[model samples]
Target: MIRRTFPILGVLTAVLLSYGLYEALIGAPTEQSMGDVQRIFYYHAPSAWTAFLLFGINFVASVVYLIQRSIKADIIALVTAEVGVVFCTVVLVTGPIWARPVWGIWWTWDIRLTSTLVLWLIYVSYLILRRFSSSGQTPLMAAVIAIFGALDVPLVYFSIRFFRTQHPQPVIGGEGSIDPKMLQVALINWAGFLCFACLVCWSRYRLELLQREVEETEALEALLDSRKAQ
Candidate 1:
């Protein structure tokens, strides 16, 4: 059923993303203060939200895997962590670009910015551990790391509320307000990004499952050959 739906989902995702691009770049009104540069916020904020969601899912999956030792759960944890890192990378990159012109610098060590960078680094480490580790307990270790990493998400989210920072307070739910039309466009872009992220995760999950099956088969064949020699 899922296989059958992939094409349909893929097409829908493409349309949403393309329309989102059009709306963000042209259809949406330019900001009075930042003008064209503020346009990056459409992509930037949505990417951060998507990354936060993916990391949250990763945290839950990792916990499940730790408790049940289920291969499926482990695969899900791995997939979400991988995709989450990519989305977080988008946030990190776009943030600096957006900051450069506004802040007159490419980066800052403010609480929000620093914590976000740390969150990205932690997940990047999780992926590195999964990729390079030869230990049988790699999944367990990775799950532990994932849980630790997820703790930072809240800090990244609330830093602006708690700390005086170079980063502006969140427009959605803070002291500041946003134009309704810009908010609408931001939301449309977010919906598009959410759909795209789900599609990517689903595709990655399938590929991971296939790769594991091949590895297991190869291991089993080797074992059978060694037994026959005995």
Candidate 2:
């Protein structure tokens, strides 16, 4: 029963995400200020949110893996970290694209941008640490790194908030609220991005499982060969 349900769930998620993307791109209204470039918001905001969500998953899974010593939890944490890194890269790339036209700059050392950059570096380091650490220490070291890296999320949010208060609010959300149509577009974009993220994470996790199974089989075969030789 459980095995049968995953395919159905995957199909449903794909359909919903496709519909949401259509709504965001063709149906939703454009921003009066940014024009067509505003469409990037559909991809950008959601990428940022999904990246944060994935990192949160990694943090929780890492802790669980450490406590339970379950390979499943470790696999989940590893998969989530990788997916989160990809989304974070998207967010970083799209942010500059959106900013170039509006902010008249490609990059800035503003609090929000700086903090987000820091978060990206933290997770990238997490990935590196996991890759280089000795096999026996991988799980314990990864858990510690994930926990420490997650602290950057709250710091980034607060830094952005404080920065806005100190500096003039960006044209995107300043002196008023988002238009109703633009807001709807943003929401739909978020939904599509979230569904896509889930799909990617699921695919990666399955691949990881397959690799582990292959390794286990090889190990078993090696043990059998050793016994036969004896």
Candidate 3:
């Protein structure tokens, strides 16, 4: 089942990405103020949205893991956190690239930027704790971290509104509205990225499940060997 759907997902992601790239790069009109530089917003905004969305998933899975101690829930929380980190990486990279020409600097310590950086760091730390540390208590600790990490997503989203920042205002319901064509492009790219994220998360979750199976098999074999020797 996975083998058949996996290749199909990859192909679909490629098609979506190619079309999205063309729409963002050529179809979308240039902004009156920032000009071509504003085009980076196509990828930047979607990546941010995707990251937040994944983190939300991670939060729910984390809660389920805590309450039920289900391995499926734990796998989901782990995969979502890892995928969310990838999206956050895109946001952090593209943000500075966009800011360089607009703000005359590559980075800033504004509320929006700071909170987002912290969000990324928290998830990165969560991944390290799960991957590099010892087992058993790690999932519990990681689940707690994921729950708290997700709490920061809302703060990052509202930081621009709650505090003064060099970052641009929201594309929706802010002081100014987005151009229709640009909004369409943004939405299109967002859809593509979300699909891409799902593909990646599914692959990671399956891989982790396989890894656990292998580990359990090895442990069982070792136990049998020890009993035979005894």
Candidate 4:
């Protein structure tokens, strides 16, 4: 079931993403103020949303693993954080691409931008601890850190509202209104990205499961070898 479903999901995601790219790059009308560069919104906005969504999943899995000490939950938390970080990287990269033209600067310490960088760094550190640390309690420690990192998501989201920044206002809610056509394009693009993120995340989870299984089998064999020597 997993084999059959996963490929289907991947194929569907690819198809959706193909059309979404056209919609974003060509179908959407250029913004009056920002012109063609604003088209980055189609990609940038969806990336940010998907990153937050995946991180939210990471948060839930972290909580579940902490509560049940389930290895499956740990796999979920790890993979989602990895995939979420990838999308977050996309957000960080695209933000500067968009900003360079509009803000005339490639980077700034604006509240929203700074908070997002911090968010990305926190997750990157979590991944480092998981990979490099030899602690038996790594998963538990990472889960605790994930909970705190998850708290930052809300802060990143609200930073534009809570403080003044060079970052643009929220597209979903503000005094400004998006054109109906552009809104549709954005929605379609977002759906495509959501599907794509799910596909990549599912693949990563499966790979992690296999890796974990191999490690346990190797450990078992090593134990038996020691016992025979004894």
How does each model score on lDDT?
0.85, 0.81, 0.86, 0.85
Worst 10 residues of 1 by lDDT: 166-175
**TM-scores for every predicted model:** 0.89, 0.84, 0.88, 0.89
Off by over 4 Å in 4: 152-175
Is candidate 1 or 2 superior in TM-score? 1
For candidate 2, lDDT tens digit of each residue in 1-230?
A: 84776677677678767876787788778777778787888788878888888888899998898789898899889988898889899989998998898778888766656766888898899889989998778878988888887766787778787876688644443326776876776677676677677777777888889987998899999999999999
Overall local distance difference test of candidate 1: 0.85
Question: Which stretches in model 1 have alpha-carbon errors above 4 Å?
Answer: 152-175
What's the ranking of the predictions by lDDT, best on top? 3, 4, 1, 2
**Which TM-score value belongs to model 2?**
0.84
**Per-residue lDDT for 16-95 in model 3, tens only?**
88888999999999899889999999999999999988988889999999999999999999999989999999999998
- Clash totals for all candidate models: 0, 0, 0, 0
**How close to the true structure is residue 111 of candidate 2, measured as C-alpha lDDT?**
64
What is the Cα-based lDDT of residue 197 in candidate 1?
86
Per-residue lDDT tens digits for candidate 4, residues 78-110, read: 988998899999999999998888878888666
